[model samples]
Target: MLRIKGTIGDWPVDLTVEMDDADWARLAQNLPVNVAAPTAAAGATPVASAPVDQLWLAAQDLLRRSGGTEGPQLMSELEALAGSAGAAKGLLVRLRHSPKVKIEVREGVQVFNWVEE
Candidate 1:
C-alpha cells in the first residue's frame, strides 16, 4: 500500500493506493520511458533568418509602431512592401491567421495586434 497526503492547488488531498509485488511489476510495464536531451556546444551560433520570414517580421514591426492597426491601414503598408494589391491581400490573409497576430474590433473597425515573440 502507498499512502500519499498533500495539498494541490489550494485543495487538501489524501490518497491511498494499494498494490502487491505483482501489481508493482505490472505498473512498470505501463510507465513511459524518457529520452535524453542532446547537448549543444557551449558557443553555438544562432541560425540566420531567411528573407521570406522577414516579410512577416516587417509586418509585425509596422503593427508595433502603430500599437495595433486597422485592416485597411495594414493592407496599405503591405501593398507598399509587396508592390501589388493582390500580393498585399495574400499577405494580409496570412497575417490574419498567423499565431502571433490577434484580431479584434474597435469602434466597429477590425484591428490587428502583433503579439510579442
Candidate 2:
C-alpha cells in the first residue's frame, strides 16, 4: 500500500494505492537494479557505495549548466537523473539547504540558481 497526502493549488489531496504481490513484482521490474557486488581486498573493509555522491555532483552540474531552473521542471529532470522519485526529492531537499544554491520566487514559482564559488 502506498499513501500520498499533500495539497495541490490550495486543495487537500489524500490518495491510497493498494497492490498485490504480482503488482509489486511488476513495479520492481521497472526499477533500476544495482547489480555490482561490493568488493574488498583481504583484511580490508568494503567501502560504502557512493552513488548518491555522484548524483549530488551531477545535480550540481545540472544547475550550474542551466544557470537557473524552475523548481518543478528541475525536479522532473532530477527525477529522471536520479532514477527514483525518493532520490530526486532527497536531492532537491539537499539543494534547498546547500549554500551554493539560491532560491527565488518568481510569479509564484520557485527558481533555483547555482551560486558559483
* Winner by TM-score: 2
**Alpha carbon lDDT of each predicted model:** 0.64, 0.73
TM-score of each: 0.52, 0.59
Q: Where does candidate 1 stray beyond 4 Å? A: 1-50
Query: Which pairs, if any, clash in model 1?
Result: none
lDDT of 1 by residue, 2-115 (tens): 567999999999998776545543543332322222233589864554333445455556677777889988999877875567656656766675667899999988899988
Could you tell me the C-alpha RMSD of candidate 2 in Å?
10.0
Rate residue 42 of model 1 by lDDT: 83
Write the residue-wise lDDT of candidate 2 on 50-107 in tens digits: 5444566677788889999999999998888877787677667667767789999999
How much does each candidate deviate from the true structure in C-alpha RMSD? 19.2, 10.0
Stretches of candidate 2 off by over 4 Å are 1-49
Best model per lDDT:
2
